[model samples]
Structures are given as structure tokens and as C-alpha cells.
Target: MTNENTAATALILGATGGIGGAIGAALRRRGWTVKALARDPAQAAAGWQNGPSPLWIAGDAMNEADVVAAAAGTSVIVHAVNPPGYRNWDRLVLPMIGNSLAAARAAGGARIILPGTVYNFEAGTTTVVDSTTPQSARSRKGAIRTEMERLLEEAAPDVPSLILRAGDFFGPGIRQSWFAQTMVTPGAPVRRIVNPAIGAGHSWAYLPDLAETFARLIEKPDRLDAFERLQFEGHVDASGTEMIEAVRAAVGRDIPVRAFPWWLMRCLAPFGGFPREVVEVEPYWRHPMRLDNRRLQRLLGNEPHTPLDTAVRHTLEALGCLDQRGTLSQAA
Candidate 1:
């Protein structure tokens, strides 16, 4: 348990990213002292819109010494950093998390809050997943994700950790998301959107809502275990048409929906890049797996939720798809 001196102090490793920035802002609004560790603090400050500006600490997530130094006197460490452009994640992901675990231990039992994904579960898992779901994913990224949680479990008791696992992210300031990357193009009008649904269903998490959930759980450490995994039930698109419909509603018109080109991605897999990665995890889209939030509800009473249209509209606006004059009307 953190002492009175460290209770309100939080150190974020990826404050420029969506979930991290949101959590940093939420904590600051709650009167907690927040610090963000970045290689260039100035660059991070320019794009920071999570809640409020945090005290910038010059450091790198890959460097254990840097993370340990920045985590000093902090009761919480948000390890949300990842390799840019999904490049070098195999080489950089574990080591960076290693540093966070080390720093968390050095901070005297500080809780390390990890922004988790559904990647830990097998891509073909059709069952509704909860914290108790078995992690049997076989893809390269999935294996890496599993190992990261294992490291966290190994560090438990000494360095308490919480894995708040959720679906793919969609919100402002998100750089690495399937929503912005594949479903809709950023910095331009969304003429058409590709539905990720493939006969099954999918889940979408609003970053702001997920981050608010993190802050709520973090504020009540007594409710957390030394190592806890909570599945967040976000927007569960059961029929696989909800997201596309939401986009249409946000645009105030019936937009044409395109099917995701799985075969093209399969053909491009031989070239070795995002296509290869996508193909490797194709089973995720081929199956339905909804995250169960019973445990989360027990702790927080209710999960933070935003209306589908409102979330899509905000995301589209942030992604520069819609302008001030081109936004949706009240009756739309």
C-alpha cells in the first residue's frame, strides 16, 4: 500500500497516447498530482488533452533506470507506452514493461495499471470472456501480450498490478487503433467505412470511458488484488452492424458500408507487415467474444459509457473527418 505521501502521485509513461492521456487528465481533475515521463516533454505537452497538463519527466520507457527515477514517490505507474507504428513491438514491448515492473517495485508496492487488450485470448474464442478466461492466443502479438501479463503476475505482492483488459480503442488522440487505422481514414472525410464484423461480432472501447474506469479503480486500491484482471464491457456490437450504423447516424446520412477485404490482406501477408499481422489474427473477426464486466460492475457500481452516436461523432471530429459546419444536425 502507498503511503499518504505517495497516494495521490501518479507517473504515466505514455501520456501523449489516448488512454494514458485520458487517465492523466482524469487523475489531475480529481486533484491528484500527475507526472508524465517522455523523451521530449515539450512535444508531449503540445498534444496533451487528457484532462490537464502533468509534470513532465524526461525519460524513456525502454530504460529501466529512467522509469525507476521518474516513478520515485509515485503510487501509480501507467505503463501505456508501445513502439510507434506497431514497429519493433516484438523487440521493445517486453523490455519496456520490464522497466515499468522494476520501477513499480522501487516505488514501494505501487500499483501498475496496464491498458490491456483482447489479444491475450485466442482469436477464435467464441465464449464470453471474463477475467477467468484462459489466455491461449497463438499469434505473435498475442503471445507477447500474454507474456507481459505473466511478468506482472510474477511481480505481484511486491509490486501490485491491475490489467484492465478491454476491446479495441476509439476516441480522441488515439494513434494506434483499428477504428482510425482501418475502419476510417483520418485527416479526411469518411466517404465509406469498412466493417470489421465478419459474420460474428466485435467490441469497441471508448478511450475516455476506459480511462475513467482506470482512475476510479486506482482511487480504490483496497478493492484491488495484488494481481487483478478485469474485463471491461464496452460497446458490444452483436450484429456486426452497430458500428457502421453509428457512423451513419453521426454523419446524419445513410453512408455506404464496405466489407472488410480479408482476402486481400491474406494475399498481402507474404509481403510481411500490417497485412501479415492482421492475417495472423484473422480468427478474432471470425469469432464472437464479448468481454464480461460483472467484476468491474461489482467494484465501480457502473461502467463509464457514452452514447454510440456521440462517441462516433467525437471520434470523427477529432480524426478530422467532419468540420464545424459539416457536423450532424439535432434531428439526425
Candidate 2:
């Protein structure tokens, strides 16, 4: 697509979320006419504003009329909507997928870009997961994600759709993510396992990079026609020791890094947002999995990735972990 065509009208679902807001901003920066879709129009407009901002469409992603109205006259649709917790999956994911498909079809075959995750792969599969990795139907979350993909494929067989999957997200405005506010908060019961010897190597995706990649995919929707899956290599793949070092550098001092007991994590699973499915995936933290993005690089050409220090700094600042002197502290 030419520079002029890159600015085609695009609609993003779940625009109030961190990744969605970032993608919206990136698209607007690239000159795309962006529209943000949400369940509450007023709340979306208030939370998702970036300068002049995109059109805000308030409606449920599962509602046919709402989806239709949101997708109208749009050339691209980003299905970024997701349920708040695992318990809401059965009630939400399928319906949202169906609604998104309906909207895409109604919009006369607009490109549909859906955010995906590494959970689709089975446990103990050590290879760098790429487009062709066989999805395991073992875990509950994995099964749910696989089923969602199947529904999307069936719903829009002709319309172009892209699935960009990445590792756990950690960046600005990502309070609910596993590594960000969920684990790092001060005075919160949760804490990071700081043993460099044991917790040093883990893979995490930066939100800014993920957002930029999604924007690029929307700009070159045709490139997605030939491929069904894309994996993004995130900012850094380091051990827990390296992660702590990065955090210290970002915060400009050493901070306590204590691992939460597995027993406590299990105990809190019921009340906390953390589910049993998430605990099952904790092996990824101990053994980092590499996500090869050779195809993404080949397609998008030398895209800039956020540096480790810079990403850490941004994340800490977003979480209010930095003081005026650039020292790490608890959020007020």
C-alpha cells in the first residue's frame, strides 16, 4: 500500500485497553482515520483520547447491530476485544468472534486483525513457535483460543484476517498484565521471584512494539491474505536475573525481588484474576520460549523494536514506579 492508502479508515474494538489504545495512537500517528469501538461510548471517548482522536463507537462487540454500525464504511477492523477473566471466556469469546466476523462481512470484506497469544501451543514444546506450530488442545485457555481461531476462519473464509500472537505483555498502561502491576506493585501481596540463578530467563512482549506491529499489519492488509499466523519476537528474552538487572537500571537502584510461593498463588487463584490455567503456564517463566519472527521481519522490513532499558523505563514510569529523580518507588 502507498503512503496515501496507508491512512485508510480503521476501526478498533476494545479501544479502552492498553494495547488497543496504543494501536489507536500508532494508527493516528501514521495518518489513518481511526475509530475506537467500545461497550460504553462515553467511557471510551474519555479514556481513549489521543489528541484529535478517532471516531468512538459505543456498543457491545457481541451485538450484531452495534458491530454493524461500528464496521460501517471501515476498510479495516481490529478485533482487540477480550473478556476480563478466564471465567468470562465461555460466555464472551465465541460471541465476540461471531460478531466481529459478522461486522467484517457486512463491511464488504474489510481486513480483520485479531490479537492472539502463545497459549495456543502445548506445554514442553521448545521450538520457536511460528505460523505453522501445531496448536495443542490440552489446556483450557489453549483450547478456548484454538476454538476462537476456528470460528474466525469459518466465519470469514474469503475476507482477509490476520492473527498476530505474542508473549506476555509488559509496558505502559498494562496494569492487569501478569508482569506489570499484577506482580510488581508495592504493598501488594504479590512479588517477583528475584533469584538470578533460577528466575533469570523469560520472554515478554512490549506493548508499544505489539501496537506498532498491528498498525503495520492494518496498513498492509493484503500481506496477510497469504498467511494465517504471525508470531512477534518481543523486546527481550532474558532470565529473571537479567530482568531484575534491567529493572534496577530503569529504577536507578536495587529493589526487593521476592518470589511468591506457589502455594499462595494457588490459594489466591480463586479470588484473584489468576486462574488455574495461568498457574499451569508458569513453566514459561522458568524456561523461556523463543518466538521466531523471521517472517514478520521479512514482511515488514527492519521495524524498530523497543530497547530493553527504554521499555523497562517506560513501564516503570507508567506504573508510577519512578520518582522525580528517576528513582524506583512505590506508586502513590
Candidate 3:
């Protein structure tokens, strides 16, 4: 249970997403009254499929009035909404954050919690970064992310904000990330695992563990600064072999390991959309970067960590790549 035994209310903006759903479920488990903004409340609630029953408010994150209405009596506003299928982020990202900021002010200085990423850092530099790292990212998307945080920082004292930064996300509840796209083929048997950081190390954040960390942070908001960004030092596999080994163990057998086809991806980037966007951020995989979570460790006594083997096994099971016998299903 949270430090406060009283039932606190929270408004989640992206209740349907992986991070949002994970945090929402965690908060609900801690006796928090969680509410969400959705275009269709009934359909969104149906997506939960017998999970925690959060009050779904019919609205959109981009609409300021909708956001404010949803956050009426909430103490924390989780801003996890993102552009659908990672499209139109350049156009929609800031606007959505702007709406959330407006709502935060209207809701009487409600605390804002954001699931942050490593995009705010400069590429090909700083293998290990802490909360004090400068925001020098040069990529288009990274620049926008930096701007979003800037807005949050500027709104400090009025609208307190907490940004938990982490690396690539993987786990149940969402299958639209690098782990879901590259590491293993979703909804198929594990035949081959793809490695993006072939020759370098990479960081990965398990959704469940990260969500639990968020819940802990929310429990002790008094320890956090008005506008603070903390790094979640999740599983950092140096050389990328550790993660490959974990996946192999999860499959309970040897599987073909393939390197991501950066060559082909670069060639197809000209067509625009997801491919183009992915190719533009190749610097991240090429460089070795890991978040330093010492601060988070101090705050939470110790960051929540699930063993790689167990985390991988659960992820594979959720992705439908593993069967009851701990072997690959013959579906692929």
C-alpha cells in the first residue's frame, strides 16, 4: 500500500499503452482511484479485458478541455499518451503535452508523471548518463522530447512534474517497441532473435519493473523535487550478448540469432514513415549508453529489478512465443 492510506485519485492520459497500462494497473493495485481519457470509454474499458476497472472518461489528450475534465479531482496526471503507431509525433507530441500542461494548471497544480526515454541525450556520446546530463540531443524526435521536458521544468512550482527516464521498453501489455519488433517476432514461435546492438551494449527497461518503480516514486512524492527527471538503470547488457543469452534460455533451446539489417533499413528510409524515422536514430544503437540509476536507488531504497531469466521468460510467454512445456509453440 502507498504511504498515504487515503484513496488518492489519478488521471492517466495514455491508459491503453504499455507504459500507461502498466502504471495504471500498478496504481490500482495500491488502492489509487485511477481514471483515464479515451476516445471511446466502452471500447477502451473493454481492452482491459477483466483487469482493474478504472473509470474511463470519454475524451482525447489533444483536447485541453477533455484533459482538464478528466483530471478534475485527480492528484497525479500521468502523461503517457503518444502518437498512434509512432506516427505524426513531430506534429502531435508537443501539442498533446501542451494540452496536458494546461490541464495540470486548471486542475489546481496536479503533479505530472511522465515516462521518459533516452532520446533527450546527444548521440555517440556519454555511455553512462545520470539525471544531471545535459539535454543535447540532435535528432528531430529527440529535440522535441527535450522541448517537452523544458516545458515541464518551466512550469515547476505551479505544476510539479516527475520524469522517469529509461531505455527501450519490453514486457507484457504492449508489443510496439524495439523488443517486440526486433528481438522476437510477436505472436509467433521463437525461431530467431534479432540483435540491434550487435557489437555494443544496450539498455532495456522491463515494463512491469519500471511501473513498480513509478508506483514507489508516487508513494513518496515529498522526496522528489518540484520538477525532477530521474533515470531508471534497468537491465544494461554490455555487448548485447547477455540479452541474447537470456532469450535463448527463455526459449529453453538454441535459436538462430540475427543482426538487425541496418543496411536495408537505411536503403528503405527514403520511403518515409516508420522506416525513415528508425534509420534517423541509428546512432543510439551504434553507441553504448546506459542510464545511471543511483539516484533512483537512493530514493526507492533500491530500484526494483526482476532477474533477466524470469523477465525474459515472462516476456516470451506474453508474446506467445513460448508454450506450456517451456518450448516454442509450433505455430511459427
Q: Highest lDDT among the candidates is held by which one? A: 3
lDDT of 3 by residue, 1-332 (tens): 65465578899999898899899999988888999999999989888832677899999888889998999988899999997766688999999999999888988998999999888888677777887889898888889999999999999989999999998898887788888988898888778988888456688999899999998898887899999889998898886688888888887778888888989988999898777888877888888888988889889899999998888888888889875545543222
Off by over 4 Å in 3: 324-332
Please provide, for model 2 over 5-70, each residue's C-alpha lDDT reduced to its tens digit, 9 standing for 90 to 100: 754888888777877778778888888888877767777677654455778877777687898888
Better of 1 and 3 by lDDT: 3
TM-score of each: 0.94, 0.88, 0.95
Clashes of each: 1, 7, 0
How do all the candidates rank in terms of lDDT, highest first? 3, 1, 2
Candidate 2: residue pairs that collide: 199-240, 200-239, 200-240, 200-241, 201-238, 201-239, 201-240
Candidate-wise lDDT, in order: 0.85, 0.72, 0.86
Clashing pairs in 1: 25-51
User: Could you give candidate 1's per-residue lDDT for residues 1-332 as a string of tens digits?
Assistant: 22243348999988888888888887887778999998899998886766569999898888999999999999999998887755788999999999998898888988999988888888664468887788988888889999999999999989999999888899888857889988888998878888767865688899889988998899889989999999898898888888888887777767788888999999999999888988876777778888989999999999999998789889988899874434845334
Clashing pairs in 3: none
- The C-alpha stretches of model 1 lying farther than 4 A from their native spots are 1-7, 323-328
Over 4 Å off, model 2: 1-3, 84-87, 155-157, 186-201, 267-277, 327-332
Q: Is candidate 2 or candidate 3 better by TM-score?
A: 3
Residue 83, model 3: Cα distance from true site in angstroms = 2.3
